[model samples]
Target: MIELRSLTKNFEDKKVLRGINSVFEGGKCNLIIGRSGSGKTVLMKCIVGLLTPTTGNVFYDERDFCVMTKRERTLLRREMGMIFQSAALFDSLTVLENVMFPLDMFSDQSYKERTRRAKYCLERVGLLDALSKSPGEISGGMQKRVAIARAIALEPKYLFCDEPNSGLDPKTSLVIDELIYSITQETGTTTIMNTHDMNSVLGIGDHILYLHEGEKEWEGTKDEVLGSTNERLSDFIFASDFLKKVKAAGAKS
Candidate 1:
């Protein structure tokens, strides 16, 4: 499990996160949801050590990430995986090579061993046939799959996704959501996703953290979200008439 204690971040003059405290349980799809500029991206970056928090502690399974030595932090990075908004696969490399990149960079395994591990991860994400194909040759959804395959190649203990379904059609988005959800469950990784995708929130969001401006507005499970009494959360989530009706119907049931 990952826990954020009084997490606060500032960009010189502007504070982006303010004393945000939350727990991301292991083996669950923990979602950070909010409108653009709500500071979700900043929070995720801080948790993943991309940005330094101005004040607070980020604990990875009880170890304080902020205080870890450079070597220790490097070692901790091997236990973490990230899927970016753009799917971030190397265009120069084939799908298999992209999946094997982490293992090649970090693992002491032989070529044959690394290839075996990469193949297993690719197969897990249903990309066996596309191993030799470059990232440019695949569809956007398939590219995301390759990213997911690469993220899990090292069997990371923690997974972070940033707007994972961005630019995909609704159907394809749902497919990616299910794939991520399944991987998190099967591997028991502490998965934290930063997204504005409401479909993902209702689909795989076992734990939801709602941010408004620079503070945590609310936190709960997906089921509890529909019935949430927090007006700001309701306004943000059920913004459309269609979604409002859905929430109303869910409440009635």
Candidate 2:
């Protein structure tokens, strides 16, 4: 599990995250949600050790990241699996190569072993047929799946996803969300997703942290979120016309 204690960050003179504290559970989909420019990305970056907090600590499995030496931190980072916002696949590499990249970089395993492992990851993400396909040959959803295969190739203890369903339709979004959730449960990986999508928040969020202008405004499970009385949270959550429509429909039933 990941824990934050009095976390704070600033870009130049502007504060981006302010004394944020929350625990993201292991083996579940823990989500960080906020509008654009609301410090969500900063907080995620800090949690993953990509960004250093100016005045706080991030504890990953009880080890404080701030006090670690550079080499120590790099070693710690090897335990992390990150899925970027764009899937970030290499255009020149085939699906198999893309999945093999991490294993090659980090593992002492043989080529044959690497190929076998990468292929297994591809099949796990439901992309066995696309092994030889380049990134351009696949749809956005397929590309996202390929990215997932690569992310988990390392078999990390912690998995971080930045907008896992960013550009997909609702159906595809749900598919990706479910895939991430299933993988987390199967691997017992600590999964943390940064997203602004409410559908994701309601569907796969086992733990949710809401941020507003660089501060955590509220946090809870999906059920608690729906019945929350926090006005800012209500405005931010129900602000979506689509969410209001869903609420209206639910009320009628």
Query: Best candidate, TM-score-wise?
Result: 1
Residue 123 alpha-carbon offset, candidate 2, angstroms: 0.6
Q: Which 10 successive residues of model 2 have the least lDDT summed?
A: 242-251
Query: Tens digits of per-residue lDDT for model 2 on 139-244?
Result: 9999999999999999999999999889889999998998999999999999999987788899888999999999999999888888888988888889888888
Give candidate 2's total backbone clashes.
Answer: 0
**What's model 1's TM-score?**
0.97
Tens digits of lDDT, candidate 1, 170-245: 9999988998999999989999999888899999999999999989999999999987899999999998899988
- Candidate 1, after superposition: displacement of residue 37 in Å? 0.2
Q: What lDDT does each candidate get?
A: 0.95, 0.92
Off by over 4 Å in 1: 251-253
Clashes of 1: 0
